[model samples]
Target: MSNPKPRIALIGECMIELQQRADGSLLQSFGGDTLNTAVYLSRALGDSGAVDYVTALGDDSFSDAMCERWAEENIGLQRVQRLPGRLPGLYCIQTDAAGERRFLYWRNEAAVRECFTTPAAGPILAALPDYDVLYFSGVTLAVLGEQGRGKLLETLVEARRRGAQVVFDNNFRPRLWASIEAARVAYRSVLPYVELALLTVEDEQALFGHADSEAVFAAYAQLGTPEVVLKRGAEACLIRCDGQSYEVPAVRVEHVVDTTAAGDSFSAAYLASRLLGGSPVEAAEAGHRLASRVIQVPGALIPKD
Candidate 1:
């Protein structure tokens, strides 16, 4: 019989998103890095695997709506925590003529910042190791702060010891970090426990000061990470697995709508393919295909059909 479907838990924040229209109107939606990945992963997996989102939200209407949306997408919500009075963070997305997007965030005081600090967090953190895979990102590290990050580190140690695969996406947003050095230190602390690292070369260069993709791969090699995938925009994505390397070119899109969640969509499809036994090259190709479709749409998500 085939192996049982893997259970994956993605940890991070989901924010209220406002997309700017050409006519200067705002379209409201919900999105975040790990949340976007969770949604896409669930869609890609269908009934083959399970995807759970682990985060703290508020008891506000927006948080309620976010959970409702996730349920509609078939993402598991047992790990979500709701705190009274606090609300989800908000952000606005603006896209240029080239389909490139910029964001303005009001997430500094989001409820998820205290995700690992509250009394309810102990049980949640303890349960993370039971999942087949645990996923988080640089934004998760930044938003969690020092104290929360310490708790996350402890949980990661336990989770790795329990044989759960830890996956990280180095989605580096310099503005979220206190300083370059602090970010470096936090990233280094988490690297030793990661099983698979999904990285963006540009983010690597900005965060760890790596010269290029080779430098980034070399750095990960030294960390003894077993599998690594490096995504380069509109170029071939490189993968290092089982001591072999493969390069997969991205699918070209004729018309780009919005570039929001492009990397998240790629990461989601890549991880979904990997979990479902796709080869590294196949997984990379899958990532590119999904990302190309996502960029042709307006928001972080597209129609299910």
Candidate 2:
């Protein structure tokens, strides 16, 4: 008999994105870290596993377009809750003359902020333990508030105990958290339950003030996670698995049109390859292949064709 396909659920928000151009105009699209990862994971896995996006959105035109886009990508949207009279968040990206990007947000009242507090959230939380894999990120944790984080931590523990793998991405954004201490506490609470961790070395250093890669590796090793992948933009990635370490070089891109979802896409492809029974080295290669292509495009998702 063939083995059953794994079910993976990614929990996070996707907002309306405005990419500012040099001509003073904005190109509109939709993206978020976990959402980007979800789309890429679904694409990489194809029919090998089921991929779902777990979040709340408003019943607005933008929400409709977002759902349509996700559907076109063959991602499962059953876990996405639509809230009445609430709208999705919006943000604009501004790039300097040198092409470095900065983000301006207007999302304080977005619908996803209430995603885990509503009556419908009870079922969603309960359903989480049943999935083969549950993936979330630091941004997801920061946006969920203290009460929601506690509930989520409890759910993760239960899900792990019941044989589900919990994957975490450390997408640390300092502006999102009130203080460094709070982010540290929240991250520490989730570390013990994480089976696989996708970390960006720069973000990790900013959050924990790690002196170097060895310090970062030592910290994650103490957490007792079986696998850890450290991403360094434009450089090689570091992988630590089963007490063995490997340095995987990133695929070089001739031109980088945009770096919006580079790390997120890499994490998605890496995890998808692993779920399909590929080795860590093979998964890392797959990740680099995808991310190398992603950075060459102008947005979070590149055209599959």
Cα lDDT, all candidates: 0.92, 0.90
The residue-by-residue lDDT of candidate 2 on 17-65, one tens digit each, is 9988879888999999999999999998899999999999999999999
Q: By TM-score, who's the top model here? A: 1
Q: List, residue by residue over 81-119, the lDDT tens digit for candidate 1.
A: 999989899999999999999999999889999899999
> What local lDDT does model 2 show for residue 32?
91
lDDT over C-alpha atoms for residue 264 of model 1: 95
Query: Residue 211 of candidate 1: its Cα lDDT?
Result: 96
Report the error of model 2 at residue 300, Å: 0.9
Residue 18 lDDT in candidate 1: 96
Q: Where does model 1 exceed 4 Å of error?
A: 1-3
- In angstroms, give how far residue 286 of model 1 lies from its true place: 0.8
Q: How many clashing pairs per prediction, in order? A: 0, 0
